[model samples]
Target: MAHDTGSSLTRIFAPAKPPAGAKAGTVGEAADAKPPVVVSLSASAPAAPAPAGAPAAKSFAEVTTDARAALDANLARMKESGRTLGMGANQGSQADIDAAFQGMDRRSLHAIASNSGGLFSKDEQAFAQTVMSQQLVEATGMDDPAGFQRDPARGFLAGVRFLDTVSAEEKASDNWRLNRAVAQTNYESSMTRDHPGEKAENVDSGDPVVNFLAQTIRSKEGTWTSVHDGSYVDDLSRITLFKDGTDASGLQKARQGAGTATRDAAARIDITL
Candidate 1:
């Protein structure tokens, strides 16, 4: 009984044999069966490697993000250096600012420099313009495109040139006082006409004074005007010539004082006669 236990279990569990005369590799009716095909459920293969020496192209979103990050760092550095963010009256070299804006795309630079959101400072705008102007010249061999006709840097540069020309002319003229008065009157009248309500003290108003000066300088009148509305060039003189100050030298009051002095001299000569 003890010895028959293993034999009985084996007999019950063992598979049945094939019938007689069956093929060597087949069992019973499985003679025509085929091997199963294998399939894999693994993940897809990785993307092919990029070609050698090819630059990885960035998506628009990535390009914008990188541009903004660089802009933030640039602004932070400018702020740490004690530069104001929105005033155009501040005077300083733009070399550092231009360096900061280098490598930025033209679209982002133009958008930021446009100051449509009023976030960029005047210096930053000017710096961006300088970079853009350089880029335009390099690309086209000319920097006078109509697209940048309203560029602030161009406006400011024009104003500086007008001032230099006037100063040089007035220096050699005997009627320098009258000539200056006329020149100043022309600028004031043109600016007042173009930017009606904009005050020179408000440099935050997108440098309207400088823009007006540029517009007038480039106009058919070319900074010459027959209209005198009693508006003084005091603010323009300070911002353009002195860079920053409340110097009243550009005021029309000087013209009035000159007239009074001339009349006084006439009266003194008449009394002597």
Candidate 2:
């Protein structure tokens, strides 16, 4: 995102302001003292609707057979990957299952996606995101209240703002360089050839997700006029695009390519905020 030199929102860093207090790592300590309560998490798409006119199986035998077949397929997939069934990551392990609902009412957590205690709850569902979101952070196998307050996204956004607020002297250090690699990859790109009648053109999205894509072309350009010309506030327009529901479709729209409007100055202040 190498852009021309006159950018306000897009920059090497943001203006500095001393924190109201020291960098408080005390969130963890204070969280430990609070009894874990059931919370609802709505960070992603909502539950899928049940199939229309699809009747339940006639008996327990059918249910058993279906479950067994599903497990067999999962096992086969594991075998192909050479991964142990109980291995780490988001693999649906019994241990992972146990920790996902940790510190909350067991029965309540069990009714996830179907009830108020589902993933949207502040209880078990939210806790699961922390343990499973990172590779280095192991599944504690203990569902406790302390991990709940350490909201990963908040921590990340806090760090982002903090980095923006730091002096250039602090930003150029070794610590910040490594942190750059940790930024999530959410960009998408590709080459395409069309029929004779179709126009050929390049598609570059200034969308936030596209900017942070995991699989990307990895261009060297920084936030610039030709790269992502729009202001940083363009992200709010993406958010505004999906104000109705948090369904899969909504998520897709909310994360659509922002490149088309990346240079449109009018879009910056267009959202509800």
Candidate 3:
């Protein structure tokens, strides 16, 4: 008798399909009993490409340009808000002032001046004029005589001499008021206050009078040395001799005036001294 291979045990242990072209009865019976389950695994679809001619992400240059534009707009708004941009409020030295005025053109100066509706107080105008004068001096090598009176380094004496000279000249001039006002403002702002033991020479003196005398002597001697040579005073020296004493220029001017007076006296009386 033929063995019955298509039994339940054969279906559990035998191959799922029969060999190619083999008699199908043996394995077909098993395959037909229970078919293999089919599983379909699909790969994910690729991402879509970006559209052509569309704007790309911004580069570093574009980003930087945008930031700079915003900054400039903010500065323009501040300027329109009636603020002083470069008027030297924080500047304490001539060098600092000069640096602030650097790269400033006439248009820029006008803009800065008119930022507050073109209305400036006397002090404001004076300060503006001082800045302009400094620029002019730097560019043309011409000194503003009034500026020397306002220079702190020229000391107190130079300031007084400058005031005296300007005062006498202004008496004959029609613009006396304006000149006097500017000069007075500059003098007041530039005057140095003396303190006890401020200078090296004043440190050893116990009495105030003695200290004053000693300071005076030191100032005079310094001024004289700065102006005087062995034979005569140097006419072209620019060194300031005193903050409270006569400078080289003032001494020269005094000498000239004295010589004129002496000559006039001699012409009348023929007197020798």
lDDT (0-100) at residue 265 of candidate 1? 68
Determine which window of 10 residues in candidate 2 has minimal summed lDDT: 185-194
* Rank by TM-score (best first): 1, 2, 3
> In terms of lDDT, which candidate is stronger, 2 or 3?
3
TM-score list, all predictions: 0.26, 0.19, 0.18
Please tell me which model should have the higher TM-score, number 2 or number 3.
2
lDDT of each: 0.35, 0.28, 0.30
lDDT of candidate model 3 versus the reference: 0.30
Best by lDDT: 1
lDDT of 2: 0.28
Best by TM-score: 1
Q: What is the lDDT, from 0 to 100, of the residue 202 in candidate 3?
A: 15
Q: Which stretches of candidate 2 lie over 4 Å from their true place?
A: 1-120, 136-208, 212-254, 258-273
Q: Write one digit per residue (lDDT tens) for candidate 3, span 1-273.
A: 111211311221122232222221222232332221111110121223458987874543443344334334533654576533333342223332233334433223322322223344333333333442222222211133244224432332232233233212222221222122222322232232323233312122122222232343344432322321211111223223233344444444544554575568678775554
Report the lDDT tens digits of candidate 2 across residue range 1-273: 322222311221111111122111122222333223222221222223459897752343333344334434545665676643332232343333333334332223222211221224332222222222211111110122234223333333333333333223223222222222122211111111112344323222233443332222143333222222221121322322223333335334534433344435446656634
- Give the clashing pairs for model 1: none
Q: Which of the two candidates, 1 or 3, achieves a greater TM-score against the reference?
A: 1
